[model samples]
Target: MKKTLICGALLVFVQQMNLVQAQDWKPVEGKIMTEWTEKVTPENAHQEYPRPQMTRDNWVNLNGLWDYAIQAKGAAAPSNFEGEILVPFAVESALSGVGKTVGKDQELWYNTEFASPKKSIKDHVILHFGASDWETEVFVNGVSVGIHRGGYDPFEFDITSALKSGKSQVLQVRVWDPSDDGPQPRGKQVNNPSGIWYTPVTGIWQTVWMETVPSSYIAGIRNASDLESKQILVTPQVTAAQAGQQVKVSAWKDGNMLAEQTIDPNGTAKLTIANAEFWEPGNPVLYDLKVELISGKKVLDEVGSYAAIREIKMAPDAEGIQRMMLNGKFLFQYGPLDQGWWPDGLYTAPSEEALVFDIQKTQDMGFNMIRKHVKVEPARWYYACDKMGMLVWQDMPSGDMGNGWEMKVGVLGSQTDRARTPESEAIYRTEWKEIMDDFYSFPSIVVWVPFNEAWGQFKTKEITEWTENHDPSRLVNSASGGNFEMEGTKITGDIIDLHNYPDAKMPDPGIFGKENIIVLGEFGGLGLPVDGHVWQQKDNWGYQSFKNEEELLNRYAGLMKRLEELISDGLSAAVYTQTTDVEVETNGLMTYDRKVIKMKAAQLKPLHDKLYQVSVK
Candidate 1:
């Protein structure tokens, strides 16, 4: 009894010491932080399951404090680490606990230790990264596992072969990002961030986790739901399949199973529902899905997923003007241009609640759609949109700027495409395809925007056509207020979008409305910076600066009133300047820290309601 008491006391002492060590970490000071910042700690930093579309019950979140080091671009891994930086947050972000920059000439390295999660010889361990910047290489127990190049897409490595027979395993990551120094699709990152540009995010900026699966498992799932046919095509990508292996898919609603089908491991399962509930704004209905891999009578792997039945297309109204249609009806889509940046986390939100806060606030303001401007978000962001019934227009992050913009309305072939080198073109194509393929399963994504304002705009006709052909289910907006390539009577893509500031406007309905859907891609950048909730104290900016909330709301009301008129004039959709203030750009519906909503949702929803009432004829 005395020995048992002594062991219990020692266990409590070690627990207290671990608590003290975790408390030693702190966020870098001197920056505007959100309410969720305080909730973030080394022990709990985005501990939610990273992937929602394809999920398994058993997995481990690798988010927390990790040893970090910055060395020269070509230098070897450092023998000594600088300090403990929070995982999943970029090194330059305040939430990282190391607000230091890793430029083009330097490489950032991360080291961590995790216990081996192997249960048997047939188990294969996979390390998954939600996203990493530019270039990244992973090492398991000092063994090079894999190298991946792409800043926005998720990648994984099978580390089963690299594991050793031990309880603890070492994991190391090396990352190098040439932000603006290279010709990659870096969005708005610049070496000298000023004006519209913001800080650079290097290293991992998303969740890192691991899971053990059977040697042959379901690698991915693709759902193509057709509202017209009342059928959903389920395609499961299996990593390793034997001759007699088969896959089973079942769709459920509430607690009842609706449909089930089994097909060859390599085939697509087509399940038809007698009466399907359509997914749309204000009433997003998602059906649960269960996929199982089986060989004869034994089940190999099973995963939980979900799908929504919806469709978006363009059709002419009574006046022969093209209008964007959702679920066979015309609905004027309106939302903010969400940049997906956080004051504390930069590319990564402080927490999952913080990530969903922006979307909730936007929806509160009566917005139905969001133009996810240049930067892509973590998968959970889209998952929230799917659950909350918010439509998304995703953009390919722009890079290789300084390619002149000289397009004019009512002119054909007014601007020439930027002449990018072979290397630059290849990088853009590879990443864009990966982004589309990786994000194709989300039902909320209705439009795919390939270029924005002629920034790195090249081969407009070819790129737009490829995007449309690749994903015929989603409409293609060739360029949002960028150069237009007129082929015959219409623009290259389905939408002819225009971007005007401080006021609501649209592409000439008389000119482009008949051939394509006309939209005010961006407008009403009314800026009102709250006193204590800004990234910087001085020199804040907006397309149209406002003195106070009353002035901003009054001006915004005027813009909405005009937007209502344009809806009747063949305007199918519109996107406001932004959902939140980013860095020095003060033209947001909410302040940067999200502490203050510049204009209350109660006031904005009524004005937005009037826009939806306007006829599209």
Candidate 2:
């Protein structure tokens, strides 16, 4: 009895000491922070399930504080770390607790310890990284596991073989991101952030997790719904499938099974729904999915998923003008150019609630679509949009800027595609494809934008055609206000987009509306910088600066009035300047910290409603 009591006391003491150590960490000071910043702690940084689309009960979130070190580029991993940083937040961010820059000449290293999750010999442990900037290498138990290159796509490594027989296992990560020094697709990261560009984010900026699975498990899930046939096509990528193994997919609605189909593990299963509900703005209907890997009479692995039925295309209206169609009907898509940056967490949001807050606020303003400008967001962001019924126009993060661009008002520019080295071209291709494949399952994504404003606009014809052919389900906006490549009568892609500031403008309906969908890609950048909610106090500027909210609203209403006329002429869609202020750009519906909505949703929603009512013809 005495020994047991002493053991219990010692365990309690150790746990108390651990709690004290965790409490020692705090967010770095001297920056604008969101409301969710206070909710972030080492114990609960991002405890939500990282991947919601394909969910399994057996997994562990590897967030919270981890030992971090900054060393010179190409240097070996350090034996000891400098300090603790909050996981999933970049080192350059205030939420990281060690807000410091890791430049192109340096590398960031992370170290953590987790208990082994394997219960049997047949179990394979997978180390998953939601995303890491640039190049990342992993080591498990001091053994090199794998290396992944890409700033936005998720990657995993099977570390089962590297694990030793122990209760605690060591995990280490090394990351190198050449923000602007290299030709990688880094979006707006710059060594010297000023004006429109923002700070560089290095190291892990997304969730890190681990899961144990059977030898043969479902590695990936690809879902697409056919509105015409009322069928849901499910393709399960099974890893190490045995001969005779099969996949069973079942679609359910409101806890009731709608349809089920069993097929070979390698093939696609088409489950036909009797009464299909289409997914659209204000009427988002998602059907639950259950996938099981079966071998004979035994079930190997099962996962929970979801799908939505929707279609996006372009069709000519009665006036012979191409109009964007949603679910076989013309709907003018309007939203803001969302940068997906946070004042507290540069790339990652302070918390999941904070991540969804921006989307919710945008929706409250009566916007149906969001042009995810340049930077890609975490998977949960898209999942939230899917649930909230928000349309997404995803853009490939631009890199290798300084390409010559000749801006023309209503005609094609004389400048051809940018001449990029083979290395730069390969990097762009590899990452773009991975990004598309990673986010293909999300039904919220309606458009794929390859280039924006001629930033790194290379191989326009080839890249746009590849993107269109790769995913025929979503419409491809080859270039959003970028250099256009003419092919006979029409532009290279489906949409001919134009970008104008302060005032709404559209492509000439008489010139290109007959061949492609015309859109105002960006406008209405009226700046209103709230004093306490800004990243910096001085030199903040917008395309059109407004001293007060009333003036901003008046200007915005005028732009909307003109936009309604354009929609009547042939404009299919439009994206406002932005959802939130970013860095030095003060033009946003909300401030940088998101504490103040510059214009109330109630006031903006009524004005935005009038745009939707305008006819597309």
Candidate 3:
């Protein structure tokens, strides 16, 4: 009787302890959090399909609670898990529910179980990760599948051979990230959070899912437009090609088939469009693509995609000054330096609606372009830009800070190139090429900014020439706001970019107008912080801060007036300081929480119209 009484008391005590722990669990509210923070839960976390470009209807989402543990680096997978963590969110993020920090010497381990979607020998279950930081290794049913190194690119492994014959399957992942300590493309992540640097995102920070495909399937596709030739290039890749296999590609507009062509599965197919419609800013026309792989008369696989017909080049304007021409016309591109970050979800956006909100808001503010500064976003973000007609100047995320940066303000100046280690150079080249390939399908991207302000700038001439040669479809800004290098006497890329603060300025027209298009790469950081929406009430800052919205608008108008004058002189494009308030930076038009818009969209629309209306002399 006494043993039974003691057991009952111990059970009651354990139940009470669990209740207390659950009550204590709350998001570590950053100084400011977004409205979406309140709505995020493990069941609904990033439920949307991740890969919009090459999508399949049948897939299983593995984003809910997962068993996680931090083990010493190089150690074997742990037998016991520390706790449950929300998948896809970083361990350091509040949304992750763990709120733990893993040092460089530690490895993050995630273990999850999923039921086999289709257990058949002919079907192959593919494991996909939208992105993960640094190094990652995957194991299925305790068998090693593959190892991937790059953090910012998507990777997958065919786990069919590793699966066991059972209803339940086991998945284990190991991740290690050194953040700023290592020489990789880490962007602005740091171990210690302060100033421009924020918290380091370790392990899986993107969607983790699985899809089942047949033995023979369509692997990938690359689409390019030839405006002058009036044809679209469609290159389809198949997993395994048969002797008489052919790939059929069709282009459709508004449910009407515009063109269709078939070619060898290994070759490039050209779909000719008579009197093709050129895609522009307001009317972002897209042609739907349907690709099917067939052997003899049997259809093996099919995939749905989309593309836009456009061209970006450098051509002389009326005054013999080089200008950035989009579809054979000079359209001045002006927008914000959009550093895609969120207060609640770092690296990953909280939700799909939250992901595209910035692009829509920027368009409403009368901007036509955006400089995706120093970071790459999910494919869905680029898809929104493609559908909404927001032209992007994608930047290769900056890293390897070992470079000796020389900031030059003149048109002709000497530049300092970094002596990168062979390993560092290889890492940079591999990641940059992967990023370019991953984002190539999105037509909204018109410019590729490889280096920003000499951050990891090396082999300037060689890298620039390589980028131009690889994708002659888009113009290459070898280094936006970077040290302009000269190949003998000429700039390497198509644009001469300059970064000026608070006031509008451009590269000297007299010096670079003849060879390259002159552009004000960055300017106008007019800041007005809302009372409750700041990262910190006391230490918030901007390039030029104001007390009220009226003053902020007035300062912005002044900058626009100066920008109009620069455009008349020879400026082809300009980028504002930022899109949103990041950390302690209060330079965004909107607040950090996205709860308040400091500048009215209605107020700035006409001012922007006036700048676009100015005709070059």
Candidate 4:
């Protein structure tokens, strides 16, 4: 009888261990956190579908606790984990529950177990990662699946063959990020962060998930909208082509079919919507898309998608000066320079709601545009802008700061091109192409700012021309606030941009007005620090500091009052200092914790509307 009791006790212990592993986890307390941090638990952390552009109803989110270990480079995966670190948050971030830094000589390892999705031999299981910093390799059930190199773009691996014959399967990943030590596009991340630079993000900093698909399925789709043509150019990519297979694309509005077309996988079909309403800033209209892979009337696979019809261009106005036109109308674009960094999550936002808050508040302030500075945000951020009718100017994150910088006030000056190694150039080219392709479908992104203030600027004429050829639909600002490379008084790209601090200013239209659209790329870094919301107690900095909200607003109003004169001269768009305070930079309109809005939305909206009214006749 005693032996029987002992056996039962052992069985109970095993059950309790399983229960402990499955319990929901909470975010570790950080030095400074957002309000959303309180709501972040394992069960509800980043629960929303990561990919809003091309989505499938059937998928699993792997964004909770995972066994993590830090080891020397080239070391084998550890058999025992050091501790539990939250997925989708970098190890150095506070929300990860593991505030540790993995240097260039170390590798960050992650291990997790998930159930195999019900599938047949003809079906495949695809493991998807929203993003992982630097170099990453994945393994399923101890079998090496694939490896991805870029840190900013999404990638996936088909692990159908590596699945084990059980309910649970083992998955492992290894990541290495050299940050600024390497020539890769590390953005503002550095080993030791201060000033404009911040902490390094080494490992997975985005959603991890999996989905099941047929052997022959829809691989991807691209949306190109032409407002003048009243049509959407959709091209679908198929995984495995079959005999008599065709790609069918349908556009729906409020459940009513507006247009449909079936074309070959390699062909682009124009889905025409009769009398299509243009997608504008206030009325952001979106059409639902349904794509199907069909084989002789049999639907092999299907996916849900969305699209926005809008056009961005530049043309000569009545005064013969180049002006930015949205659907052939002059609209002055203005907003904060969005750095896209979070104090709690570092590279990642604490949650989707938190991600939307910044965009929504920008719109509420009556600004029509946002300049997404250096760092790239998750796809959902652009999707939010699309829904809210906020225009975006996306910047390619800068790296390789070893180049020489030559600033020109207004004239075309000598360019100091960085002679990057072949490997470094290849890395930049590959990542830039991927970023453009991944974000091409988002109609909100009207401008692509390839370089910011000459940070790692190189191959000026060649890069600008290449970008124009790659995406002719949108105007390219080759280098915003970059070193001006002039060819007989003519600039290379579409716009001539300038950067001035603490107040409003613009590039001299007399030199650049006839050829390129002139813009104020950055200005008005008015700062106000609130107690208990700062990243640090001392050493906070900004271009101009204020003692209270009234003083800050009065200073901002003065800058706006000066900006009207520049607009009359020929400024097309302008970007303010930033959206929120970051690290030691207290120039943000809001505090780092996002707890206080120094300038009220109601007060700023009218002031912003007056700037838009000063357009050239």
Best by TM-score: 2
Query: In model 1, which regions exceed 4 Å deviation?
Result: 1-17, 407-414
Whole-model Cα lDDT of every candidate shown, in order: 0.91, 0.91, 0.85, 0.87
lDDT of 2 by residue, 1-617 (tens): 99999999998998897798789888889989899998898888888888888999999999988999999999888998899999999999999999999988999999999988955789899999999998999999899999998998999999999999878899999999999999999999999999889999998999999999999999999999999998888999999999999999999999999999999999898988987889999999999999999988899999999998899999999999999999999999999999999989999999988999999999999999999999999899999999999999999999988778676654455477788999999999999999999999999999999999889889899999999989999999988886888976699989998888778877678989889999889888889888988888899988888889998898888988998899999999999998999988999899988988998999999999998888554
Where model 2 places Cα greater than 4 Å from the true spot, the runs are: 1-10, 409-414
lDDT comparison, 2 vs 3, better candidate: 2
Model 2, residue 70: distance off in Å is 0.4
Candidate 4 per-residue lDDT, tens place, 1-617, comes to 99999989998996787567646455556478999887776666687888888898879999988999999999998899998888899999888888899988999999999987988889999999999998999999889899899889999999998998987999999999888898999889999988878889989999999999998998788998878788988888899888789989999999999999999877787889987988879989989899998888898899988887888888877777899999888888998999988888988999999999999889999889999998889899999999999999999989987766555544333468888888988999999999999998999999998887777888888888888898898888988876766787578889988887877877677767878998888988888878899888888888889999999999999988888887888889999998999988888888887989989899999999998899587
List, residue by residue over 419-492, the lDDT tens digit for candidate 3. 78899889998988998988898999999988888887889888888888887888999888767777543589
Clashes of each: 0, 0, 0, 0
Q: Supply candidate 3's per-residue lDDT for 280.
A: 78
| Model 3 pairs in collision | none
Candidate no. 3 TM-score: 0.94
Clashing pairs in 4: none
10 residues in a row with least lDDT, candidate 2: 407-416
Query: Could you give the candidate ranking by TM-score, starting with the highest?
Result: 2, 1, 4, 3
What would the TM-scores of all predictions be? 0.97, 0.98, 0.94, 0.96
The global Cα lDDT (0 to 1) of model 2 is 0.91
After best superposition, candidate 3 residue 173: deviation in angstroms? 1.0
lDDT of 1: 0.91
Off by over 4 Å in 4: 1-26, 409-415
In candidate 3, position 386 carries an lDDT of 92
